[model samples]
Target: SDQISKDESMVGFVDDLQFFIDNRDGETVVGLKQKLEICGRGAAFNDAKKKKELFAKLLMRFERFSSAQQLFAYIMAAIHETFDTKIIPSTSSLSTQEIDAMIEAEIVDKIMAEIGEGSDHMTLNRTHIKGMIYWLADKCYVRWHCD
Candidate 1:
């Protein structure tokens, strides 16, 4: 199917992101390398299936909403800036989860400030923000650590 049709079938349920996980089939764009990067805790990250579903749903949102597409780009830029300037230069070894948490926190802070300044970015809760980060990982747009 084309992108539009796929998005039509799997629109992002922003109000209830879990709907995607509950309704997802086996379909996913997450390749082997992306999976390896995303599943940082090996078997302990047992929610890979749910994460994949959310990633797919995020793709749908990007396709369906211009605001979402803009947000995606903003998130990618933020992650690159933070990871390159801060995380990479640090001598300490941060676990993937910790790195993700730090990135998410920084992104949220930036976004909140933007919203306060009357930026056009859509407002989303923490769950939606985290979902976007995971989706970025699945799409190879960001990594929790350097390869």
Candidate 2:
């Protein structure tokens, strides 16, 4: 059995955002390894059921987290789920407002401020968020795995 919790496993799937044990799964959540290989990315859904299901479940699961690592996992998962190139939803629940808010609440605004005003070509975007989440997840996952 893996010593790492499910949430830790989620890190590989998602990042450094904080997470903790939750009653929902009756144990620590799992982590991810390199971002979830979401199929179809964001697209259009065949029915409303799937749309509502993912939206509610995913968001609820995220609400259970207490730290950044956990939140990062959700963000990364969102990115993977919404990539739209490799694997996109037939109909995605994600919206610009929702995405922006999530990014702002969990990462974007913080990262932007932390980067400072030195000026550079790179700016906030899916790619930037992707890298940050991966790097952070990798670090936290390693720690949990090693311990």
Q: Which stretches of candidate 1 lie over 4 Å from their true place?
A: 1-40, 43-52, 58-62, 95-101, 116-123
Off by over 4 Å in 2: 1-34, 38-100, 119-129, 137-147
Per-residue lDDT tens digits of candidate 1, residues 47-145? 644664665565564555544554555655675566568764541587667765676567756765654432333345544555555555554454444
Candidate achieving the largest lDDT: 1
- Candidates in order, TM-scores: namely 0.52, 0.24
Taking the tens digit of each residue's C-alpha lDDT, what string does model 2 give over 38-146?
2121232223224334433443454433343344455544443333332123124555455446545545454445544322321234335544443433333211121
The whole-model lDDT of each prediction reads 0.51, 0.35
Superposed Cα RMSD, model 2: 15.9
RMSD of each: 9.7, 15.9
How many pairs of residues in model 1 come into backbone collision?
0
